[model samples]
Target: MNKFRDKLSTRNTAETGVRYEWYALQRCAATYYREFEKPKIIWGNLATRASFTYDEKDHFFINAPACMLPTSSKFILGVLNSNLISYFLKSICAERQGGFIEQKPVYISQVPIKKPTLSEEEKIIKLVNKILLLNKRINEIGDKKTSESARIEQEINKNDEQIDEIVYNLYGLNKKEIAIIKDSLMK
Candidate 1:
């Protein structure tokens, strides 16, 4: 890989022929993550809503237009996917047409995270894991129109609501702030 590294951007490689051994990736992130697997949160860079997802596989080669959170914490996933975080991101992130917000890392990083106690964090992780399992089952079921899929989705929604409540309480948000969070999502 070292021999081919300099050749990549040089005129020599263009003439001699390309070596497929080189990792086709960004200059910095490529070399480091090649040998390691760490859980990361992947979220759509441009989406109609907050869609922060936990990267269970821990494969670092996520494609373009997604923001990466450099942590494996399911508790963080629970907080990120909550309505409160979604509302927070939407308020600050740049909005494009079609209601999609530009969830650039610069903006995503600004979303505050309030650390909960170990037990509370564990509770959130459990809920997040439940949602992950439900999501997995839905994927296994494949067809979205099936009763099984619907049931799993309903459970996921319930889990999401629970996470949101937990996050709201953790942040000590007022009813008025909660109302604003809820209302901003409406339109």
Candidate 2:
């Protein structure tokens, strides 16, 4: 990839004859360099259609848009990945074929990210940390079906449920509202 680094330096690559002038590759590179001082949340364009796919990496987003937040908090990702956010996206996004919705910059930028209370923020950060740890464990374990792996998987599931419930409460959703959200996602 180093060889191709200069490809986007200009509108076109002279060596490979590849053109990137059409896309904002140079702009992306500039943002990437600037984001190191203040990291941002990286997520897929189709995040709402699928799961709330996101990463905390300090890398350049090529075709994806990064949320340039003041703090590089993973709790924001925790909130974005919650079931409540997914339901909210589904409701607002325009439907495409195959039942997939385009989670473009326009739609994503409008997502209402609630500012949690101090206590709520702390709890959310803790839960997100645990979730990240369990996910790391699962990756480390690979496909091996050890008893320990099974236990870890169970714990991960439980933590996920807790996160979902916390997010719902944070959004001030009543039981009936939560039920409606679940029903919508099921379909």
Candidate 3:
């Protein structure tokens, strides 16, 4: 065990550009949240659906599911928020009376991800960024312009649909599989 510990690499991480030893005392603590770069994805420990979002803050998470994914890309955000992954997670997570699902780190680790090519990743990031901007604009507009807010929401919806399509293509899911996922979501 000592030999293995000695062999552990102490290096910088691409995700945050922060260096740390494999067995750092801080990382081994009960909180389990490690140092992550800003603009990283964060989601609740429990959710009825895939509810992941990006935050530009350095935080010590409390009451949050812990997962160490070295993702600092908006493409990852797009994939997580897509209907495909949502459907996959909903099917696997334990359900409660009010449709609450226990989206613990254990199940999250089991998610099947197809690493995108450079071009594909860029495309997804572009679309996801557009959706993010539209959402921000909606929030900024507030109730001042209900019509403008509605228009921005429609734009967001369109981008979300595009994202789902892109995700489906990424996984090579056929018509039947897509239909099944769509049906499950409607239920």
Candidate 4:
């Protein structure tokens, strides 16, 4: 994602470029919200509740959850807004479009922030890392289960083949007879 971010800043603005910017903005908004907001909300909610505007030819957006006000938590709101500005200044400035710009402000809900101390931030970071690690372990276990199931299926198939060979030998059936019997069983 960092590599993509690097590429995004250097790329030319076309249709794909616009799409990339849209995606990057969405991700940046979500990240900023999560990093600053309390009890992190869903990305869909953030996207739906927030919007962008062109400020003096500069594209900017306020990302907030519904039913919140920027005035409600001015400090956190300022932080989030600043983060958005920095992300754009650093990443999205190169993708700015030409004409057809509007100066109206895009009203999105204000993000709510729980003013956490440094210790709280550290705790949150540790918790988030633990959750991520657990999720990764769960994914690995799921993959291993899938692989084991496939291995068992293959073993069963081999056992069936051995059983069929034993039955053919017991019945004194020739290769052609065994083939006919196998075809009939398949049908």
Best by TM-score: 1
Least well predicted 10-residue stretch by lDDT in candidate 3: 26-35
Return the clash pairs for model 4, or none.
Answer: 64-111
Off by over 4 Å in 4: 1-109, 143-187
lDDT of 3 by residue, 1-187 (tens): 4566755554325544555677654533323244464456777867778887776666556445644444677898899888999999998898877888877777888888899888888889999889878877977887786888888888888888898998999999999999999999888
- Estimate the lDDT of model 3: 0.78
Count backbone clashes in candidate 2. 0
Q: Sort by TM-score, best first.
A: 1, 3, 2, 4
Report lDDT (CA) for all predictions: 0.80, 0.70, 0.78, 0.37
Q: What is the lDDT of residue 95 in candidate 2?
A: 78
In candidate 4, where is summed lDDT lowest over 10 consecutive residues? 48-57
- lDDT-superior candidate, 3 or 4: 3
For all predicted structures, in order, the TM-scores are 0.81, 0.71, 0.75, 0.23
Instruction: List the pairs of residues colliding in candidate 2.
Output: none
* Winning candidate number (lDDT): 1
lDDT of 4 by residue, 25-103 (tens): 4443432333334432222122211222111222233644323222223223223332232222222222224311111
Say what the RMSD of model 4 is: 25.9
